[model samples]
Target: MIKYAVHILFLILVGICWTPAEAQFVNLQIRVEPELSAEVQQELDFGTQITNSGRSQIGLGDVNMGIFSIRAYYTQNVYLNLTFPDALIHSNPAIDQEIPMELSISYNNSGLNRPSESTPLPSEGGLVAIHENTTNLTSTSDIWKEMYIYVYGYIDIGNIPNGEYTGDIVLTVDYD
Candidate 1:
């Protein structure tokens, strides 16, 4: 027994140079953008007024001011919530008239569409932050960015009882 056949040829050369261990794989991705919008270009008309005993104003560079357009994500940061209507009802549901109001807001990203060179916004609405205007940068508009909102108010026509009057102005935006 030549040392048991050289220990069976060194266990068949260590089982032919053994090997058993392998696992390597990797792949991952992500891209989700599209959600942050507000568009009402204009609609807060305070026209036709006649019953003055007091406040019946409409000044915020009034052109029947009410123009909102905010489509963000170009470095997003926004929060505007305005839910007006203290009083102004009587679309003639038998005319149980009511009129007494006061609302106000303003904003402009300074891209200059001129909402009367807007600024003041705190009649209750707040936090509108988005600043990175590299001359209104555009590599095909850089993934959207536009801000402008203005809505004027005032109406305490003390002797109320006209024919038509309506209310409801709710503009809520998020992501602060």
Candidate 2:
């Protein structure tokens, strides 16, 4: 009975010494980031191939050759450059040879110029600017702005010999 009383007294002492403590709170903040970028792309194409078939004695002047087109994407601006290796060349079948002829280039549907009009291309491969981002240019029916290139062959029929003539118009496109 005395041991039991001692054990009870020890328990009472431990309970009296123990004390309750207050709890605290901690606040935290977090954040996240994302990537914002666009990929640039371009496409260039030529219209129908032009062939001036048979002809009689003609006068001297510029002859319309063909048309070209350019499509750019994912950019607010674009640039176009053209390089002509050689003008329209006339090949003499009898002699099996070719001669370079004087050629010039003009454009319609160019964003750099007035619409529905023609602008001559400079000889030094001038850079043509195109406004309006291509993000909205999704399809052919979409409000797509086309850059039309026109090829013209200058000829003096009186001074040159008659034969089959050929030429190439190269167009390069890029995001500005």
Candidate 3:
């Protein structure tokens, strides 16, 4: 038909104009823009800044959302490890207690400076559990969850008796 002939002609014209596929194009670019912030907790607004960085885009990567490190300097030389929260605190806006989540973090502290040097912490457990937390991390893209570094972090001595305490949080990023 006339339509078929016209389609063939168009293809021929395009082929004449474009070079072979292998050498046709150069400088293909992909990009990812990262934004990081943290959920404001009660009486505390601890947060993390996520930077996707320049000239980078991944199909996916695990991001530890929130602060990465927490350092508390005190007179008595108190110390605490601000661990990452485990699992996404999934909740429906319509429901309160009904939620779905499956996430956890565990590490071994060989007591580098605790107790006896010979005694390992014996897999003394740690958790990345959820809290009543929320953040400005509202995204319309699924790529972020897969390709972003989650900034999961928190402060220490969060549950202690009345005492004068001081600490400063430190968060860092590493790429492989």
Candidate 4:
């Protein structure tokens, strides 16, 4: 039959001159950083113990040192410092003499007013610049902000000879 139709039209012109295949590409990278921390949930109660009835000018007013909460996890925007240890010693160890006391700190946070760089603690204890970030806390959406600590005391107990007195206050959070 004419050599089988010329070998089936030469295999259909070699399958219509076949040709098709080519394409490729690639790329990838990643980097991230930002995290800080702080903790002191709640502890700073200066209550109940205040006995200087002899009164020669001993004002123990405001003394509601409760709810001194501070549970931060910041990444940025921070400036909270409260360091005092210049004087809060009351060691008389049988006339060894060491009675000095004076500390005043105020706060109601969110209303923000304490960070004046703090000055006045020499008489006993001082340094109260509670917060200076001015509400720009920025803890990266962990949803945490609370500052409600108030402690005020000034004693002159007429020649100082009483007893029992201890102190410790150190709260610092950097990055401003």
Q: Point to the candidate with the largest TM-score.
A: 2
Rank ordering of all candidates by TM-score, starting from the highest: 2, 1, 4, 3
Cα lDDT of model 3 by residue, 66-98, tens digit: 212211111111122333233222143332221
Cα lDDT of model 4 by residue, 68-160, tens digit: 443333223445456656444565546544435555554444423243322233333333333334355456553444444444454333344
lDDT tens per residue, model 1, 1-176: 99999999999988887778799988767886575777787787767778756776777777777888887766677878789779989887877768888887888875455767778877667777654463556585565777887778787776767678888878787875
Misplaced by over 4 Å in model 2 are 1-64, 74-79, 85-100, 109-116, 132-144, 158-163, 174-176
Model 4 steric clash pairs:
87-124, 121-125, 121-126
For each of the candidates, give the backbone clash count: 0, 0, 18, 3
What is the number of residue pairs that collide in model 2?
0
Model 4, position 91: C-alpha lDDT score: 59
lDDT top scorer = 1
My TM-score estimates for the predictions, one after another, are 0.36, 0.41, 0.18, 0.26
**RMSD to native for every prediction?**
11.0, 13.7, 22.3, 13.9
> Where's the lowest-lDDT run of ten residues in candidate 3?
70-79
Model 3 RMSD in angstroms: 22.3
**Residue-level lDDT tens digits of model 2 in 1-176:** 99999999999998998889889998876753211122222222222323432222211122324455554322324444566644445665454334344545555444443323666767655555432344555575444354555555533223345556555656555564
Candidates' C-alpha lDDT: 0.76, 0.47, 0.27, 0.44
- Those runs of model 3 whose alpha carbons end farther than 4 Å from true positions after fitting are 1-32, 35-140, 146-163
